[model samples]
Target: MTQPSFGVIGLAVMGENLALNVESRGFPVAVYNRTAEKTKTFMAERAQGKNVTDTYTVEEFVKALAPPRKILVMVKAGKPVDAVISQLKPLLQEGDMIIDGGNSLYEDTQRRTEELEAVGLGFMGMGVSGGEEGALLGPSLMPGGTPEAYDKVESIVTKIAAQVDDGPCVTYIGPGGAGHYVKMVHNGIEYGDMQLIAEAYDLLKNALGLNHEQLSEVFAQWNQTEELNSFLIEISAEIFKKIDPETDRPLVDVILDSAGQKGTGRWTVVSSLELGIPIPTIYAAVNARVISSFKEERVAAKEQLAGPSGKYEGDVQSFIDKVRDALYCSKMCSYAQGMALMGKASEEFGFNLNLSEIARIWKGGCIIRAGFLDKIKAAFKENPKLPNLLLAPEFKQTILDRQEAWREVLAVSNQLGIPVPAFSASLDYFDSYRRDRLPQNLTQAQRDFFGAHTYERVDKPRGEFFHTEWMENS
Candidate 1:
């Protein structure tokens, strides 16, 4: 039999779907799982009449693929990844490539790449986004590896990636885990986007007294607009329309309030802190999830927490307009933060990431895919060294125009005892960014007094640190 063009290990839904996708695109694929039965069952059911081979062992799986083989591992991240790599190392020849499509940490990818390269094997740490359906159809593919390794697999990856007006959503990210790093930030932005949408839903439901139907209609209208058009917005509208079969209510109403996360958002925040990058909006979104997870504590605290308990008597249409504006403005800030973090990471990690390309690929398939990303792409294309998305003329002007409504929504939410942390943080980030001067001088003075940490003065030139004798001179 002819050798398969590609191999996929780990027969979970993601792995199986991706293998099917490869085969559908006319590439013969070999598949394997730790449980041999899974490989057999998947091939029998999903791979029937397709160019697919099922292998019962690692050696058999490796041998089934063509030389200088391209193998994708979709198993769990961390130790399982190491275990699989260990198992594959003995069976694979030199020059064969291993692509990790899991949500592994970028640092881990870097280490694994070096380890594999030492043995004359190539490693690609790739980030595959757009969930299960996207896997079965197309996903945004971010692969980081040597140029030679990338060249070998680029054709297949591009073919399996979601297509946009410009091109496919797959690109060769920089070497040594840059792909996973970008995906980590992508997930961070996803968290921020979802939280902002949730806050808008809460405000619309509580402040405007809108039912699920009205909420769905509102989101549907917003999704039609250029600024708020996104996959998350589109799905949220659909979510609001879903009815619970047993409860006879909106599915969202029957669902629990507690949110569950799988760590990418938290990883993004940790990376930001380590990089000394301010991603306040994304951090706030992660914090919102953490707070949501304390469902029992929140339920208990609500009885004792006292705040305003009255209905919003404002004009409902006007309030809805303001909330929509607020949501868009906050969404822009969240993207701004995520992009700025990526910029810092690129410089720090020597990734030489093409920000415009990243934005272009992100315009489709990814969770954070949005119409606004086209604008971001344009901003970066206009100036590759653009400091932040908020500094772009178009974005800056829009935020300025929407600031009043944004502030008004925040004020109203606070007065009515609703917590809109992500929205609030976005506004604060905007305010902080535009300020020429801040109260940090007082903070510096306090630090100096407590720990003799010197301070720089506005009256003097920069780099001239001043120390005060507070006890004697004061």
Candidate 2:
């Protein structure tokens, strides 16, 4: 029999779907699972009548593939990934490639790439987005590694990736873990988008007194708008329409108040801090999830805490419009922060990332995919070194035009005791970005006085630091 074109280990839902997706694209695939039953069941069920081979061991799986073997590991991140590589190392030959299709920390990817390359093997850290369904159909693929490894698998990757109007949503991100880093930032932006949508839902329900159906209709309408059109917003509208079968209420109402995270969002925030980059909107979203975890404390404090108790008396439709504007403006801010983080990482790590191509690929098949990404792509193409998305003319004008309404929505939400941290943080980011100067001068003075950190002067040129000895002067 002819050797399989590719191999996939880990027959979990995502792994199975991706394997099937590859097979559907006319590539022969070899599949394996740590558990023999899963491999047998998958081959009997989904892999039936397809060009798929089932193998029980890592060695068998590797041997089933053609020369210059390509294997995709869809196992869980961290130790499991390392274990899989260790198991495959002794069986695989030089020029063979291992692709990690898990949500791994980029640093780990870097180490793994270095280790494998030293042994004459090629490694690719791939970021697969669009969830389980997308896995079966198509997902946005970001693969980072040596060009030769990417070239070997480019046909399969592109054929299996989600396609937008322009092309398939797959790209060679850069060398050494750039794919995972981009995916981490993508999750960070996803957190911010979800939190922003939640804030909009709260403001509409609590302040504007819109019911579930009305809110869904409003979001449906917003989805048709250029600025607010996105996968998250579309799903959010659908979510609002879902009624709980058991309770006969909106499903969201019956769901738990607390939220859960899978760590990628937190990784984004931690990376931003390490890089000295400001991603307040993403940070606020992560913080929001953390605070939501304190459900018991929140419930108890609800009765103990006193907040504004007046009903919303604003024009309801006008307020809803304001909320929509706030959502769009904040969404822009969050994207700006995410892109800025990527740009800084690209420079710092010598990835030489193409920001425009990244935006183009993200326009579809990702959690944060949005229509506005087209504008972002155009902006970066117009000026590759565009410092921030907020400064891009397309986004700048929109933010400037909608600033008043955004401010009003935030102000109203604040007055009504609604927590809109993502919205507030995005607005704060905008305000800080547009300012000619900040209060950091006083901050520097205090630092200098206490820690002798030194401070730069406005009258002097930048990078010329000075120290003030307050104790000696006194």
Candidate 3:
């Protein structure tokens, strides 16, 4: 009978777990779902004897919470989110805030925030990572809104966020769509990480002739290393060890080759292109997924297209070491690309993001959680104006030390006809970033000759542009 301090809309797995997380943190929570049966079932199964309240109607859901209610909406992104907000808007009074805890497009979040704030209500676009189990226990929370709005729920969110030695994996990202934008970039980096890991697995299995068990062991060993330690690597090791009950084969081997995507990766790539930031590694990852989805085309082409007939004939242990080094170096470049894209986006969108705090919050709970994030946190802490992660002294030394191994892996993969798009793209990005001069001078000359785009001259101030009639009216 005690008044609930917070409310949750939607009874999906994430919403249910998040509500339970709040209740476990000693905050009274009211939960509601459009379908009353879900609410009934959750209250019976999950919320039994817990300090939770269930409301079957929107009016009841709104009234059960104390004044100036903080409601976390976990519905599907897009239209469903708009629908929920519409329903809540009419019943709620001024000062009641709605927190969208879904992977929504940041533009939509920007629009919703502007609209709600115009009407004297509060809106926050919060990115909740760590999936279902993390929601029940803890999640990495990225909230973007007015400082006052975030302050209202800071205690509850911080207590429920994953804790690390530095602090909890939660922070006020920035105003507008900054939180969702960060989450989108997080997913982009995830895409790059996954693709790079798959390349390593492919190299081990196809190039080195290692079986699933050996693959599992290799990843497990890599997980113990300082650089390659990550949730994805840890889970990949377990994935290779899983046995398919029906086929008695490695579960991953028995699974389909095609992959699916939910658009966040594509969004990141598109945003980077619009902002003129080069995130080639993430772009390659997204394209890899797209190519994977074309299984039929790939199967047909595999027969028609000819590939290199040679096999890898090298020292097995030495090649494995090279592959590990390549993965680590390529992974660093991929992260650099994502971080640089975020830096540019922050500038364009006025997010005023704290890159050090962002890295600190990602050290745990999230899918991209890795040991290297500590270095990133330290890098930004040491220089808040750090333009790119690749320029950080610690990271610079890592790539420099590992570039030879990275190039060796790529060379071997290329000779063996193994496609390593993410690896190739990341190496290209790294090489391009390190180079003081590039062949782009020819590109600019060509552009100027063809289209008169006006090229900047090296002999003049950087901003001065010139166009020459290369053919001399011939």
Candidate 4:
């Protein structure tokens, strides 16, 4: 007999599909939605045989499950998660398991886990990715909670996850909030990554004057390259190839440049700033979105500031090639920034994370899933504290070998007044690395000399900080 599985709370598109996925994988599931009517509606739909089943509200949801039940919560992050937990507490018995499958903040997950653990309830904060389709067809799963709790749920998650030959789309990341924290960071990285692709599209459309089919071909070919291969890259081809019948122009040209962004992109930029990671491309992406919001203002600015705009002149292929390099470089910056946040979170949360495993799981399961994910998995498996993603050997080699090409691309784009945000950032990071000594250190020294701020000793042993060095140097 199939074990009874219940998915509590959100029964939106992702949750509904996931329930279907679980049922398809041979588990009988009872689903609950916040609105009692939604549950009834779901059951009625299932009765009509339209993608739903065993639907119930909070009370019926609890009663339908067996003792020591396994219930997964799929609600909006923050207050909604807490609200559902509060309402469900009275109905749940001791030893029941609840998994948070939403995009909640990690610290909140950790706090909630401890709170639930005090009452003998087991908690798992899981990060589910691959969107609605992946949810139904086997999305990537990251679960963090008690090892024992994960062990109890592992088989269920694994069986329903996407398979890449042998590996499942699921893994137990760490203890406490690690799962959700990883997920939050995962979303953050996704924001930057999508933005870079958009920038690439914009560059191709505006600067290179490539038609939809040609641009689509470029992206399609890029998907085959290990350096730029990703689902995003692959999809870029389709987005470009889309054509509008009314005007007979590529659909991309008609789409508004001022695209809407969810909170994740803004959160990524904010989090990166807090973590002190350089993420110029991600920042550019965020800014670009913001700029889009002021469509009228921009139009006004266009009229007010209009003058001679620089014309992009050069080998179109060569410029395209350079833009590709820039995209990689900016992508590295965003990855580095996102990882830096994880490092800080790890220190704060007391969970030892495995970056390699993070990379491995992301390779095929998440939106950010891509060929380079394998490189990250390898790099972190070798050196966990890695300060920058670019320091990852493959990335290092890519930047070093193709750096000239990237710089050339940025140069040509600038010459033509093409605003290549990611491209510009890639060149900046590369040029900064090429220098033997950073002038920022000199500026820091000057700041310390005047402000009496603390400074690190150059001559002292490693990992030492010294304020007296200022006195000696001055």
Q: Where in model 1 is the C-alpha error above 4 Å?
A: none
Better of 2 and 4 by TM-score: 2
Estimate TM-scores for all models. Answer: 0.98, 0.98, 0.98, 0.89
**Regions of candidate 2 where Cα sits further than 4 Å from its true position:** none
In model 1, residue pairs whose N, Cα or C atoms come closer than 3 Å (at least 3 residues apart or on different chains), thus clashing, are none
Error of 4 at 232 (Å): 0.8
Which parts of model 3 have CA positions greater than 4 angstroms off?
Answer: none
Report the C-alpha displacement of residue 128, candidate 3, in angstroms: 1.0
Task: Give the alpha carbon lDDT tens digit for every residue of 1-474 in model 4.
Answer: 344655556788777777778777766777888677877776677424532345456887777776668888888889989998998887888889899998877778999999999999999999999997788898889899999999888878988887864388678888998998788788777867887787677677777777788889999988888878998898888888888998888887887767786566666667667766666766776777787799988788987774445445678887788778777867777776677677776776677887777778887667888887777778887888887777777778877777787667666666656566755664675567568777776776787778767567667887765554567755
- Candidate with better TM-score, 3 vs 4: 3
Where is the poorest 10-residue window by lDDT in model 4? 46-55
Task: Give the alpha carbon lDDT tens digit for every residue of 228-293 in model 2.
Answer: 999999998999999999999999999987999999999999999999899999999999999999
Give the better candidate number (1 or 3) by lDDT: 3
